[model samples]
Target: MYTKKSTLALILTACLLALLLVAGCAQNNPAGNEAGRPEKQGAVTVTDFIGRQVAVPDNVERIGCLYAFSGHVVAMLGRGGDIVAVVEGLKRDVIMGELCPGIGEALVPASSGAVNVEELLNARPDLVFIRSETAANEGEKAKLEKTGIPYLVVDYRNMKEQMYIVEMIGQAVGEKERALKYNEYYQRCIDRVQERVQNIPLDERVRIYHSINEATRTDARDTLPADWTQVVGAINVSVNEELKFLEDKYFAGLEQILLWDPEVIIVNEAGVADYIMTNTQWSSLSAVKNNKVYQMPIGISRWGHPGSLETPLAILWTAKTLYPDLFSDIDLVAETKYFYREIFNYPISDQLVAQVLSGKGMRAPKGKAN
Candidate 1:
């Protein structure tokens, strides 16, 4: 019923709309998200330790990250909005939602050791990321293979290795150029830390006892290389000469720690430091006698892979605490702020930074965690 003029006008409008749609499609390349970097397509073909060829994805819509640390890396790589599930729930669940509000779902399993195969299968992740050190166990590997999910095991990032993992993961997920930029920037942090510590002799270096929830009442002897000790330059007291039982990888005795007698004791509970400082039995140890014991910040305290990123701060603090005269230039607070803003893309104010690095643990800003 349209007039001839109305019909001709409608046809012209439809042609213009088609051209606009084509233009938008042409411009639609997946650029970087709000997190660290985007995953990139790379020339290198990587085969995981498990013998599976790394499968490249066209679009990674869903991801099942297997460790809290891996989850943190995923969050960092700009997938903060799309992670379908994380291992053992959200990595630092208290901080997860608040830290990255865009993510809508978190499917955590009842247990943490093994990747809950059933839950992951249901989540239908297009890709899976597990820190090789934490998640490359036989059971988990078998489950991933049987389920036909492509997974990669990333190494724990220290000052030096952080760039490698960032780029490697970025490439795997299709964010190549951004990962390289991130890699270079991270390398600078490593170089700066190394420059500060390289001059200190091994003997003069602070003997750090990175404690993992060891108390008199609790029968726990969490050892070194397992804790933040995984980071390069972190002295592994658990594997040192005194703790013969640590060699067994099964059981140990208190005599091991007492014998090693580190220069500093890092405690899971801040109270442990207070007790060690005040305890009658602790008077003999070099760390306690000299008042060298201290508390750990977030990732370093956790001694897990996600916490691996905190190695820089841990090193800075240990150096200052151990040889303040030598490490006068090192500033842990500024370094922490840099990592939050530059690497993780979290905008932490100076006040929030103070709360995060306080000797005591602080909850997220929300009274009831979102």
Candidate 2:
């Protein structure tokens, strides 16, 4: 078989073997790993909040934030620069806008729910983050899948889930270590607050009514406010089953609120506190009579809202508000500055610190204002 055809076949076989070896090496170790060249990374699998396993790219440099909390968590993890696309309202958030100035220039969809796939594809995000509600929509889900882009569903109903969701974002973005560190501080804040307030007896606890936008609209049972109120040893007056208009509804009539006669009224909106204080109908309330109405502080988001990442600070503030003597040493101004600096690595301005502590200049509604 020592012929020219046999000689040609052997040479072709050797060339094919060499090519196969080069291809295998490329798969294991991608090109451009030299000193002057760009480095390509590997893949990592992380389970999202909704229990979906996604293979996320390592060192993800481009992110699309469809969920409201995703951008905040990313910023907290010191990856704000990676955000390439965002949902509406990030630019309007006061703290978020400051923390990540690029948010103002990012590609935003028409709305959180109705994302234009063609527009998003143009942004070239490595991963798209959305809430479970959005992911549940078959149309949106299908559109994302067809594009061959990975997405993570980040949704949480309670405080425990909130912490987990943040960590999950960290995992997706290759910042698991930082996420755990943040959660440690979050837990410590909870432990410190609970240790001081847990001893308060049922009758001794401050009775509170958390007003949302309108005076009558308050927190329902099994909501974020309901949990935090209990955490700070304050009794929420609007947690009654009858007061709930529907499942998870938060509508309490004026008559019902009057019947409860809460000791403290915390309003989330800007001018509602003054309105409740000046209104003749609310004059009979114990909170108004004692002049103990306080506005909830606005930070990265409305601290009292379920969607916010500032719940730890909210708990501390509420505890101090209810019992001044217990948290007398906690200078909220100092704490606010420290929190932003330590967690988000931003040295907060003194003026903004004062504004946040006073809860003033927060005229717009949550998610609609800066």
Q: Best candidate, TM-score-wise?
A: 2
- Kindly report which residue stretches of model 2 are placed more than 4 angstroms away from their true locations once superposed: 1-41, 110-112, 243-249, 362-370
Residue 245's C-alpha lDDT in candidate 2? 66
* TM-score versus the correct structure, for each prediction: 0.71, 0.83
Question: Per-residue lDDT tens digits of candidate 1, residues 1-370?
Answer: 4688888998999999999998666543222121432244533455543345675565766777665655666666667666776754454444456565744456664254567777776666667777564354777667778866667776632334555666666776666666665666555645655666666667755555655445332112342234334322445565434332342233334566677687666665556777777877767888888777776565323322134445555555555655677667768788778766776677777876775566455433344444
In angstroms, give how far residue 177 of model 1 lies from its true place: 4.4
The C-alpha local distance difference test score for the whole of candidate 2 amounts to 0.81
lDDT of each: 0.58, 0.81
For candidate 1, what is the lDDT?
0.58
Model 2: how far residue 178 lies from native, Å = 2.2
> In candidate 2, what residue range of length 10 has the lowest lDDT sum?
30-39
Tens digits of lDDT, candidate 2, 1-370:
5798899999999999999999777653522332332123467888887788988878677789987789889988888877878887776777777667677778886384767886676666778898777788899889889877789988876778888988888988889898887788778878988999888888899999998767788887777678877888899888754665653346887888899999999887778899999999999999999999999888777777777788888888888999999999978887788788888898888998878777766434565633
The per-prediction CA RMSD against the true structure, in angstroms, equals 12.8, 10.4
